[model samples]
Each structure stands twice: as C-alpha cells, then as structure tokens.
Target: MPLPTTLVWLPETVSTDEEAFLLAAHFLGESLDGLSLSRDPLGKPYPARQGHSIPCLHISNTHDGGQRLLLAAKHENLVGVGLDMVYLPRMRSPYKNRAYLHRLAARFMAHVEFERFQRAAQQDDEEALRRRVAAHFSLMEAASKALGTGLKIGAFMGHSASLPLSALGALQIEPWVQLFFDDLAKTRLVTLKAQRWEAYWGSDDTYLISAVFLFGNEQSKQALQLDYP
Candidate 1:
C-alpha cells in the first residue's frame, strides 16, 4: 500500500452507459489515453503509477434506466469493491414478488435494522418503501463487496429474505468480515469514506450516485473532482 489516496468522481449524462465509463477515468485521474488502465478483466481499477506495486480495487455500476453512474475505489491491497446505481423509476412493489429486493435486504440487515425497516414498510407506500429498502440493501452489498467475499458466497448465500431480525443483527461483526477488517488494521490501512450526489442527464432524466472509498495510510487530503465536457 505505497500510495494512500482514493479518489471518487461522478458525472451526469444523458447516456447511462457512457456515464459509467466517464466516471471511471475521472476517478482514476487519467486521461482518455490511459483508459485501458482504469479497468481490469473483472472491471476493477488498477492503481495508478507505473511500477508502483499496491493492491487496488474499483467498481462502477448503473441501473437499467439510470442517467448516472456510481463509482468506487480503494488501495493498499483493498479487498472487493462493488457499486450499484439504480434508477428510482425502476423500483417496483416487492410484496408482489418478495424475491430480489426482499432477499437482498434480508441478507444485509441486522435484526434490529431489519425490524426497523420492516416497521417502516408497513406504514409507508409500498412502491416508495421498496425503493428505499433496495437502496439500503444495495449499500450494504457494496460495503460487503469492498471487504471481499462479494455477495455471491458466505453471508450472502447463508442468509435469505426471511432471516430473523436477531440473526440479521448478528451480521454487524461476523467472523469472516472481522478477519478482513483485522487484516486492514494490521497493514495500517484503515480509512473509509462515503459520498452521495445527484446528477442530471439532458435536463429530463436524473439519478443519484453514492460512492465509498477504502484505504489506509495512503489517502488524498482533497476531494477529487473531474470535468467532463
């Protein structure tokens, strides 16, 4: 972890797909000429600076109809990093099919958190509540990916949407996740930051972008910004 800075940037666009690519270079501080360096085979960003060996992870995502893209990155042998951006328009009623969003939320929440969210759902509009719940679930999924294991194995598969509140509560510091944090601490890499912003596309479409950065000794002192014409 020689370099200790994590930079994140988001841009508004009329083209949802393009926004994903644009944010990648902007966050990496590279020109179009360095485009190839921003993504690995798995789409994670490689650390900048030639010959500088450091572990780096990055992710970018956009919802099916979203006008904005969310980007994330970390250095110092950072583990998995996942970012998900969904258009508010795409959220549907989960009660009709409590599979996708419901399952995701169930896997991410602690017992108390799940109960609180569930109570809120009972009183709120079903569609709106689904969006909120999905957003939260996605955030946790992103955070979990940043710590490694992604959302494919372990905690993810072990838990389902019907998980008990008490069981969800126990997820705060699971042994596997704890071990990841321990490794970061042992290596003196212990910085975490999150950002949220709204982006406009073509004056008609808009979406929100949330980003998280994880690093340790090598961190930037200033917020990263990139200009897109």
Candidate 2:
C-alpha cells in the first residue's frame, strides 16, 4: 500500500562511512544534535547518543578502492549489522579463471567445500562457479564485519580446519544449486557454535554484495566497562 523507503548514496557523492552516516541523517530529516556519530571498540560506526528521547543507532560500513561506501543502521540494539559491497571485476581472476579459483579455494575454503568447487569446475559451469565463490566470500566478510572482528575469523579462507563439526553444516549447500535468487541473490540463516547468524548475499553483472547481522545476545556478549556521567 505504501512505497518502500529507499536511500541511495552514489559512489561519486559519498566516499566515507561517516559522511554516509551524516547523509543518511540528513535524508531522514533528523537533526545532528539528536544523534551524534560514534564507533565501538572495533572502530565500527554507530550513534553515540541514546535514551528514551534519543534513538539507539548502530551502523556498519564497507567499501573497496573507489567503489561504494555502504552503511546500515537500526533502531534496535541488535548486536550489530554488517554490510559489504565488492566490485566483481576487482575479484576478476578468481571469478573467470577456473585455475585461479581452484588455487584460491584450496587456500581459503574448507576441504570438502573445495572438493565441491572442483566438481563444479569439472562440469564447466564457469559463471555459476564464479557467482558462488563471490557470494561465499562476500557473506563471510559480512559476518566478520557484523561481529566486529573484521576477517580475523579468517572469513572463508583456511576456516575448514578451525570450524567445529557442527559449524561445517553452513558449507553443505550443493555447488550446482544457485545460492542466490535464480542463482543470483539469496538470504541465508546460518547456525554455528549453537548460535544463529542472518545474511543476505547476491551478485549481478558488476558487483557482489552482502549484509550480515547477529541478534541480541544470540552470541555471548563481551564485557564492556562503560563509564556514566
């Protein structure tokens, strides 16, 4: 019945996350005084001011060399939300070249997952393989961003050895199946270490994008010593 709210920050117009945040505030007609910019221990952006009158805001931003700077905000203190946009061309070699993808998968993906990739490569489904690999990394990066850990969890690379047996279920998706809508876009809920993570990922002709989020207390909270006035 109503039009969906839309916000687009053209790459030429916005270059940094902080600027993007301010642009969003302006777009919503909210005053600078009402919400101040802030970042957490991990240097992720969020709103510093909060209370009954002021809103609690959380933000996450990502960009790749002259590409788009994306930020996400939520009124709820839902752990954190992370989003990333990657220019597929920048990931070219691995996308178009099976040899490159294999080398990459061997070093980054889980052993079984890599085997799946090998099987897919053998089938000569280059485009599907390309999108799947791109979506996979994008999703993982988004998850790490949401967790405020960056890629220290190693994203998808070398994770086969470190992940728990149950966590490996996240990799069970068959290679031939499109991970995205019509094999181009998708929303995935993942369970790991007894916790759930929310993610949406897709790729088009030009770019790969993903957004990941962890809900309140879904994962154990780290103790923070906040000082009060």
Candidate 3:
C-alpha cells in the first residue's frame, strides 16, 4: 500500500509555510496516490482521506521559520516523527554574544548542560559555542515536536514528590529539575537523550535542521493520542 517506513523528503524552496505543507502533502500523496493529509488533534500531520481512517503514516514538518523549510514523513507504521530547523546565528547575532548565550542557555538547558555551555564559552573561539547551542536547540525543538505536543512548559509544575508525566514534555531543562531527576528515578524524565530518541541533523552555513524519528513505544502513542487537542 503506502511506501516503506521512514519516507522523508526535504524539497527545496517554497515561499510560505502553507506552500511548504501543501508541497509536503502532495509529495507524500504522489508516492501513495489518493492519500491526502490531515492533522490529528495535536496538529501532527498524517495521511488521510474522507471515509477512511488515518493511516499509520506519521509526518513531521519543520516549525522553525527561516528562509528555508523542510518536511519529513514516514509510513508503514512508524509511530512518531519531528522535523525542525534553526537559523545559525550570524557573526553579529545576539546568539554569538558569549554572555547572552549563557544566560539563555541557563534558562532552557539543564544545569549540567548549561555548565557545559559555560565551559565552552570560556574558549577564545565563539563559533564553536554558537554551533553547539544551535545544534542542541535543534534537538530540543525536534524532541518536543516529535512528541506532538510542542513544549509542555507546564509539565514542570507542582512538586517532585509526584513528578508530572515528564516524558510528554520537552525542553524542561530547568536547573532545579536536574537534582530531582536521575537515571534511576521512577518518574519519567523530561530530558532528551541521544540513545532513546534519534535526532539527525543537517546544516548549511546559515541554517541547521533536524529530523527525529522513532518506531516509538505504546506509551508514546497513548500520550500523543490522548493528551493534547
């Protein structure tokens, strides 16, 4: 029926987000004709047509806006996917400013990770740090998007005694959370690790983009299907 799983296409140059998504739908449909696109309650794209159920195709599009755009799609039963793009901050960009970057990182990155960021900032070269943060930011966006919930800022609410369902949220890198969360903790962690979730990146001189995909587990499917509207 549909093409094999992990069918991704990053077509070039479409003027607007609407244009990009339209291209993505038609591109996927062409491979599996008569198939159209639809959004689930949480806005993740999936192939569909009237009178038929949503296909197992899990599609993701880059929500980061820039001069360029990308879309990734999977069929044949992959459960989750996320595509994200980040504009590499220019030499004069605020992101390249050492102090600013660290401040921003401290807010969004895990304390340990931010400490790592601080160390990188100590180097004479700022470019490496810029690229590192951009890449990490790309992973964060992909993680949230892949989860199909965007970012769950609220998942950090309440106390650690009964930690929230941390897995559904992404980018919960608050410095405080690090102490309460660890490898052996019973509560799901909000961190995105390279081992469990795969984040693949591609970058040009100006932009960095990523596609995160997974066969995914039943727990993830249930979270995505029932958690968000």
Best by TM-score: 2
Ranking by TM-score: 2, 3, 1
True-structure Cα RMSD, model 2: 10.2
Scored by CA lDDT, what does every candidate get? Answer: 0.40, 0.51, 0.49
Model 3 Cα shift for residue 215 (angstroms): 1.3
Residues 1-229 of candidate 2 have per-residue lDDT tens digits of 1111214444676765667776766665556665566665555566554422233345666666466655545533355566778677666664458667667556656555556556655765666667667766666566555555454344454322232211221242342121211111112222211133455676678887776645543342322211111
Top lDDT prediction, candidate number: 2
Report the C-alpha lDDT of model 3 over 6-39, residue by residue, as the tens digit: 3334445555444555566665554444555666
Shift in Å, residue 192, candidate 3: 15
- What is candidate 1's lDDT per residue for 109-191, written digit by digit as tens? 65555655665566556555555565555454444434332343455453231222222111212111111122322222223
Per-model C-alpha RMSD: 10.9, 10.2, 8.8
Off by over 4 Å in 1: 1-23, 26-35, 38-44, 48-59, 66-82, 93-104, 120-122, 153-209, 217-229
The clash tally of candidate 1 reads: 9
How high is each candidate's TM-score?
A: 0.46, 0.64, 0.61
Worst 10 residues of 3 by lDDT: 172-181
